[model samples]
Target: MLNMQLANKYAKAIFEVAQDDGKIDEYGTDLKTVASEIDAHKELASFLVNPQIQPNAKKDLCAKLFKEELSVSVYNFLMLLIDKRREVLLQEIVREYQTLSNAAQNIIHAEVTVASALNEKQQAKLIEKLEESTGKKVVVRTKIDQSIIGGVVVKIGDRLIDGSIVRQMQSLQKQLMAN
Candidate 1:
């Protein structure tokens, strides 16, 4: 709960900074990069969050790791968190920041995976359906996933709409076995 409060504070700060610099898109990409970096390095994440590690050391390490990737404002903001003993909240902060950033800009990202690549007309139609369903501007990223066998799997935020033939076959097999 307290982490959420802190995250909101930091996220708002970042959003404002990005807006002022006209780097909202770049900042969004930067945040995702930072999050991915932390995700890829589990030991580093653990070390950063460990209470036994001195806060100053953590701050230095963070700065060193992200010096090239982060802007001065972002670096100072992260240092501020370290000074406040809130360095452990990076994951929550990143998550909340992304949520707020997306909402602020009315940006939504979705992905559609199908057994084969959709033709241009099919892509447009699928995007139209998503817009009708979501009632928002839909930016659909398309991908080909042959493992799907057939049909499509759509993901919007955390929700998944699976219309895949593989899943349908499994479901059908289950019902038949019960009979």
Candidate 2:
């Protein structure tokens, strides 16, 4: 919980900077790139988060790796995290920043689970339906869950719309038992 709070705090600070510069999406993309690199290279991630490693060394390495890739503000933000010994929260901070960015852009992410993969047309239709229902732009991430048996389950934030065969069967069973 404390870590999340810290991440949110850091994310909000950088988000505001991005907002002021009118580069919210660009900053988000830069953060994502840095985070993705760290996540993809486990050894590099360990080096950055290792308390035994000196902050100067981490900052130098990061500068060499990202100085050309990231904007000045974002590169400085990375250095700030190293100075504060909060580099460990890089991923969480990036996630929180993305959440803020998405909300600001009036976009919502949805997780759609189905018994099998939806083809292009089916996926588009589902996205259209979700957008129509929510009145917000929808970004869909699809997952295949065989246990669903059939049908779809859509999750958006706190809400879950379960139209899966398993759920329907369970509902029918409950009704029959109540009779």
Candidate 3:
């Protein structure tokens, strides 16, 4: 909880800076790249968070790895995290930043589960419907769960819309039992 709070604080500060510079998406891409690189390379992640290593050494390594890829403001932000010994929260900060960026851009993420994979047309239709209903741009992550038997289940944030055959059958069974 404490770590999340700290991450949010850092993310908000950088988000505000990005907003002012009209570079929110660019900064988000940079932060995501940095976080993913660290996650993909365990040794590098350890080195960044290791208290035994000197801050100058860590900053030097970061500069070599990301300076060319990231904008100046983002690169400086990375150095700031090293200076503050908060480099360990890089991934969480990136996530928080993405959440802020998505909200700012009026985009919402949805998880769609179906019995099988959705083809391009179907996926496009689903996104279109979700966008129309929510009045926000929709980004969907699709999953296949054969156990659902048929139909689809969509989850958007705290809301769930379950139209799966399994759920429908359950409802029918309950109604029969009640009758």
Clashing pairs in 3: none
TM-score of each: 0.70, 0.91, 0.97
Per-prediction backbone clash count: 0, 0, 0
Q: Which lDDT value does model 1 have at 125?
A: 91
Q: Quote the lDDT for 16 in model 1.
A: 91
- For model 2, give the 10-residue run with minimal summed lDDT: 71-80
Better of 1 and 3 by TM-score: 3
What does candidate 3's lDDT look like per residue over 1-54, in tens digits?
999999999999999999999999999999999999999999999899999999
Instruction: Show model 2 residue runs off by greater than 4 Å.
Output: none
lDDT of 1 by residue, 13-129 (tens): 888998898887777777777778878999988887788889889877888898788877777777887788877777787887778777777767789999998999998898889
Candidate 1 versus the native: TM-score? 0.70
- Please tell me which predicted candidate would have the highest TM-score against the true structure: 3
RMSD of each: 4.5, 1.7, 0.8
